[model samples]
Target: MVIKGGILLAIRYNSHRYTRDIDFSTNQMLGDINKDEIANRLNKSMAIMGESL
Candidate 1:
């Protein structure tokens, strides 16, 4: 997780809000990580959450 490496924030808005993109915020340590890492980590998180499904 980026937060593990020092990402300090995160924000996500619903697509139903009429926005074209989800809004995100972070004090992410980009040099230490990148978009793919964030996405993959989030996906893995979702997989864990979805195990209940």
Candidate 2:
């Protein structure tokens, strides 16, 4: 996921005020993912939050 906006900038440098949510984006095409692969990748992503792949 590609983080952007105020949340991303705040994470980079601590902010006195910030939003309560995180915003992210991906270059993935959901239509191309198969069911089995989708389950596998979802679990993998959940296991590795905040870590670069």
Candidate 3:
């Protein structure tokens, strides 16, 4: 996954901004969407980073 746009900059500087959007991308196609798996991965990653969604 890749992060871009204002959210990335905000995270880099730890500054408050009005942007309320997050954008991510992947190089390869995801054949099927897995809600549970995605949520688990996201939660785990956020925990590792001391953050939450």
Model-by-model lDDT, in order?
A: 0.53, 0.69, 0.75
Judging by TM-score against the true structure, name the best candidate.
3
Off by more than 4 A, model 1: 1-23, 29-33
User: Per-residue lDDT tens digits of candidate 3, residues 1-53?
Assistant: 78777877888887676278777787657776666887799788879877543
Of the pair 1 and 3, which is ahead by TM-score? 3
Checking candidate 1 for backbone clashes, the offending pairs are none
For residue 26, give model 1's deviation from the true position in Å: 0.9
Predicted candidate 2 versus true structure: per-residue lDDT over 1-53, tens digit per residue: 47677866776787655687766666778676465975697678768865763
Worst window of 10 by summed lDDT in candidate 2: 15-24
Off by over 4 Å in 3: 32-35, 51-53
Could you tell me every candidate's TM-score relative to the true structure? 0.42, 0.43, 0.56
Each model's backbone clash number: 0, 0, 0
Tens-place lDDT digits, model 1, residues 1-53: 22321222222332233423344556656687677877898899869868966
Clashing residue pairs for model 3: none
In terms of lDDT, model 2 sits at 0.69
